[model samples]
Target: MTLPDPADQADNPVGGVRTTSTVSAPTARAAWSITFLVMILQTVNFADKAVLGIVARPLSEDLGLSNADIGLLGSVFYVLFVITGLAGGFIADRVRIVWVLLGMALLWSLVQIPVLLVGTFTALIISRVLLGAAEGPAGALNNVAVFGWFPKSKRGLPSAVVTSGTSLSKILVAPALTVIVAAYGWKAAFWTLMIVGLVWAAVWLVVGKDGPYSVNSARERAKAGSAGKVERVGFLRIAALPTFWGGVLGMFALYGMVAVILTWLPSYFEQGLGLSRVNSGLLFALPSVTGMASMLLVSFLTDRLVGRGMTVRISRGMVSVVALFVCGGMLAALPLVDSAWLAVFLVVAGYGVGVASYPLMNVTVAHVSPERQVASTLGVFTALFSTSGILAPWLTGRLVDAATTPAEGYTTAFQIFGVVAIIGAVVMALTVNPERDRARIAAIDPLACADSSADDKY
Candidate 1:
């Protein structure tokens, strides 16, 4: 079947429903219910994939593997994640959000069954690849589905909430896995995911839809908004955007580090730091806790500061600089610590600060792209971010394999990675020539006129 024109960014979703604009209180409430349901699917996407890494502690011991081998397993996921993510944005441009998300959710989660039989490295590698492939679409497609509901002005918190699901998963997964792995063994964890997956599939069926309320719902609202809203943003144009590139590089640096930790850190704590499984998880989960805090606070701070007349660049920079500095200091200090616990503390602290940028594009896409194209714009953002995932884990693996000790591996690797984060910090700190892009965007506004289906309420 022919797909929707990839360049079309009308407010109408793949299902032909216009999913933007105000609606009746009851309908609006219904819309929120759907949006939050999507959040649950996304939470599963994060929690399932992340919880795997925590289980690596037990899984490795069961299989008698080294940190480097486990790192390879993580690398497999990134590789497949890149493959799926590479085209997820374009697919979002053409496909219905619900169908794509549902199919992918079921497809990826089914792969977890193989982990129960993971006695060999090759078998585990295949499972990770399947997991990555599943994850790729969920992150990118969920963004498209989400941005369709909220207006540009209100996107900050909602976007953060969706993105924060990953953190929420991290907080819950660490300790939970510690217990599950101890009692039922690694096999039990995958079985738990299997059950959750089926339940989530049911939730998506009931609550998932085009959006909170659509253009039709708008005229039904207490506050009737404007009329005749439309949008059209395409890959060709998004590729030329300077801010898009900035987000690409910035998101890459941030996620590459995260992929590194998710795959390698558990092994690092066990071998390099000499901690028990529970203590090691608690120590490792520190960054996620900090990340959760930043996810909420930074959005409010960015939106508030920018509203008070700060340039977009300056507003974004405020969080980036301080966060990166904290990240850098912690990373640099981690290897120097004599105590393993001290090292764990420093690493998590630095990582927490660095990762505040994880949700940066959620806001940037809302502002820089056409309202209707929020999902497609975010798809590219996630695509680029996943590309970084492809490389960072492998590179971390190579580094760990090369080093005699986990401390040396992380130290040298993070030193280089910290420099990369600093470069992003400098870029965010500098003011973008908004005038340059403003004119470029203005020149394209005429073409945007052709997108008569655009919904301006978003």
Candidate 2:
């Protein structure tokens, strides 16, 4: 099939240039199809991350591992995460993103092979490290790819949809994996994920193609003189913005909390709350149900607000600030609650409310960044915050090991993260001003800002 020249199509307008009269129905369908496919990729990506947590009890028992050892296993997966995330972001900016995604998915499948073959702790660490490296860039790359399919005004919902893959993993993939662990064992779950990754890669290889608003398409438009002059900016200059740092700090807290949830939540429910494994899995899935709904609602509303000419400060920044605060409050109160069900409610509500920040912060950062530098900027943003992944799991393990009781340790950990989330809210409230940041960026690179505003218009 011949690819449609972005120069000939007006549907995927960029930089305020309209090459055609109206967007075609086919183009819209293709955009959503690709968006959903990327969403599925995210589902698979997060499933890989959640598998260890789901099987934590069984894996720890079979291997005769302690809580600290399990935490270390969780921590090890992030050893190369930040570095690879940065490198992958840069790579995605220069290369075709479809190829980058395909490669990562294939590597994800291959990394599981070692663990499947060798069930030792050392082998597991090796697998985790490799998997971390492969998956580190997945989030940023996926968002950048999805952003290429939709205009600036319409990006929020799509971004939410893409990131919601994490919630989907918890809600859908986690329970299924838990069942597999219960019936067939932890190793069987790894085998299942490996096969799933390979299957996704095969399908992606055949169907994946860069979208009309992609970097390649931008270059093509430039060449055709349809898109105005495309100018690039230094990554450092972009990173120096207050908006960038604030979004990073807020996202850092959220990711740390997410790491704790992904690495230890199931264990927490089973050990700390005295729930059976099956019940714990079901409880674990509960938060994502709310999280998914909140995420979609927030994103959809943000897009609508932006369409109505609302400032991103209100549309994106304030929303994130509020979410962080709500999340922090609920998490902090988790330990104070007497009932196990109440504690569960805190986890579910806090996580559900706070997760709305992910897409908002992402889109906010993207708004301030030069279009060409978005992937790299997002990479740095993700890399810095994702370091929390390394620290959170390890520290929680240490906390649990040091506490007199597992329940006390778990409560303490949740309280600390809750405080972190509140602090994130304050930071976001002070620093996130996308309108101001966009103007600042415009002053540094006028053409970049022009392109950005033009893209936002449609």
Candidate 3:
């Protein structure tokens, strides 16, 4: 059998494959620019989602929403978001992502406007539903664009940069929107995010582009028509793989924790800890600051280690498993802490440590996937993992409603999900062997894996 190109060995220590030669300075600049914009765009994307949770308390009062109602409100966005994401990923695989991103950003921004004007529970629901639909494809597409710009070996930082937006948005949105909501009311917060979306869209229209890799990938797909087409690993086959399931399960647990935090953290502070809204916002942003640092550190370290010839399993997989366990423990200890500062420290530290896994997980999926299926596979991952958003918000709300005290509700919710995180960590640690999965995928898609080594027995 022909050996995989030595060039393919460079990008990732384990299974990564990049279709480009050594990057030129100008190309590197462009790639980094794209990475920066992706980070900003993700910041905007999450800001939109998080704004609702930030405003949830006041919005509930203005419209007479119960905890259950609030839960439903948060869940509405994912209803169509997931469905549209499925279609959107298929489209991204076949087309330029630049326009798709622009259109979605514009629509989500416009959707925010009606909520500010109409100011009703139904209006909020409609706005969130539309926003959700528009943003559904955002995660998959954004990552596709980012990955296109950089090689697999260099992906960790960019991936982390993009994923960091979720945490970064917490840093910015929580404090800024808190002040806005406090001063001008919750509607102002909506208006602020709308402007943010519109501005981000405008900037993206100027700077946004699908990188050369994406262009080349699309051309390859076009040329592979009919007879030249390679049979890809089936969706079910992909789903059945240990790597995929582990990633999905692990992400599900972590994301569930994230959802609960975004939707209820402020409420917890206000109702459970007896903190003021501003203080809650400040505290919320605090953990995210730590998260931002942790994100960058983890990504940088992964790349450095991989470059130094460490196994991907050690550099990426083990790191993530440890972070998950640490995060889970911190969360489980959250309800046990009585001091306000201790509670804040625990929550913040948990989220910060948890973020270390985001980029590693995304890179793992890419390293093990067929080149043409990257976007679609990521969409599938997103779809599966995003179920956490649906279950977490609704369940937390239900729990809170069932409890006599909001503190009890919040405590019970944290402890339960904490266990989930640990379970996911254990499964992921055992199952996500990148080397094994890479070989399995290569066996069925030789053409797709041409750039990848086929001789490694690991």
Candidate closer to the true structure by TM-score (higher is better), 2 or 3: 2
Residue ranges of candidate 1 with Cα displaced over 4 Å? 1-32, 117-119, 212-234, 306-310, 430-439, 447-458
Candidate 1 per-residue C-alpha lDDT over 1-458 given as tens digits, one digit per residue, 9 for 90 to 100? 12122223333332244434432333456656666777677767876767657777677777887666766777678776776776775665556677777777787778887776754677777887888887776776675666556544345556666776777666776667667878887778777777787788877777676653222222122122214333354556865677667666666666777777776676677766677777776665677788778876887777676556665555554466567656766775555678876776777777777777655555654456543454566666777767766676668768877998766886677667766766665664453333344346646764342222232222
Off by over 4 Å in 3: 1-25, 215-231, 451-458
Q: Of 1 and 2, which scores higher on lDDT?
A: 2
- How high is the CA lDDT of each candidate model? 0.63, 0.85, 0.78
List the candidate numbers ranked by TM-score, top first. Answer: 2, 3, 1
lDDT of 2: 0.85
Better candidate number, 1 or 3, judged by TM-score: 3
How many pairs of residues in model 3 come into backbone collision? 1
Best by TM-score: 2
Scored against the true structure, residue 40 in model 1 reaches a CA lDDT of: 74
Candidate order by lDDT, highest to lowest? Answer: 2, 3, 1
Worst 10 residues of 2 by lDDT: 1-10
User: Could you tell me the lDDT of residue 332 within candidate 3?
Assistant: 89
Query: Residue by residue across 133-155, what tens digits does model 3's lDDT show?
Result: 88998887788788776656677
What ranges in model 2 sit over 4 Å off? 1-26, 223-230, 453-458
